[model samples]
Target: MPLPLAPLIPLAVRLGLVATTTFALTRLVRSATHPGRTDQRAEDALDDLGEGLSLHRPADRAEDRQTNATARVRRVVRFRGKTWELDAGLMARVRLNERKE
Candidate 1:
């Protein structure tokens, strides 16, 4: 069957736009789900960690330790457009995405 050229041109343009939009959307989702670990802190925090007891640096001062002890142990972090409350284990994972502790 022969199709009209004018209608076909508009249809092809619309399809191209739709394909481009879908491709962009997919890239966004993929990047969020599989975020690259580009920060040094995050890499260091996750480095050479195995079935051994983890070590934490001593507090800078007695006051800092006292304040930290009274503060809440849990922290809230945002990842991939979602909010996550991190305990001990999850905090390590989130720290990998930052440049500082």
Candidate 2:
């Protein structure tokens, strides 16, 4: 005997819609609460390094660092409402040297 799938189709569609709505709402809330490109960038870099490095920046200086880079290969980031200035080239160089040792 074949089972009935017609009734399950509507249920499945409703569940999918709910899941998508929840996901979208969560993202919207997160973005609104924390609004800064620098903060996001810094967090991503730290995650990539996996060096247990933490971010600390002064609230007053956050705006300035967010728009400026220390060097050609440098980037500014904000972490926990603080500004972090990172020099990617220098970091890479140091990492390379460590590997060569």
Candidate 3:
């Protein structure tokens, strides 16, 4: 006996439909997991660098010997999103983004 083509047509249609849906879903998942769309890792790297530098002291005994060492040591950092601006003067408006957990 020969297999019926009419019965196989519905089965093939269902299988094709399922395969297309699965392919689309997998593509969406891959796009979602892409690095560009996920958490901002560069911001974390910058924060780590800043923290590491904060733990070290630069070789500037001349400035340390001065009476205005505190004034010279003061720093103003303005970080918006991924952009960062550093100012070493007074009377400034520097806003920083809150660190993530």
| Most accurate candidate by lDDT | 2
Per-residue alpha-carbon lDDT of model 2 for 6-101, expressed as tens digits? 989999999999999999999999988966466677555545553333344445555444222222245789999999987552122111112334
TM-score of model number 2: 0.32
TM-score against truth, every candidate: 0.30, 0.32, 0.32
* lDDT (tens digit, per residue) of candidate 3 on 7-76: 6898899999999999999999998895665446744443434211122233553334322211112345
Q: Please report, in order, the local distance difference test score of every candidate based on alpha carbons.
A: 0.55, 0.57, 0.50
What is the alpha-carbon RMSD of candidate 3 to the true structure?
17.0
Native-to-model Cα distance after best TM-score fit, residue 6 in candidate 3, in Å = 1.1
Sorted by TM-score (best first), the order is 2, 3, 1
**Residue 42, candidate 2: alpha-carbon lDDT:** 54
At residue 73, candidate 3 shows an lDDT of 29
Model 1: lDDT equals 0.55
Q: In lDDT terms, how accurate is model 2?
A: 0.57
Model 1 scores worst on lDDT over the 10 consecutive residues at: 89-98
Candidate that would win on TM-score: 2
The Cα error of candidate 2 at residue 101, in Å, is 67
Off by over 4 Å in 1: 1-4, 35-101
What's the count of clashing pairs in each model shown? Answer: 1, 1, 0
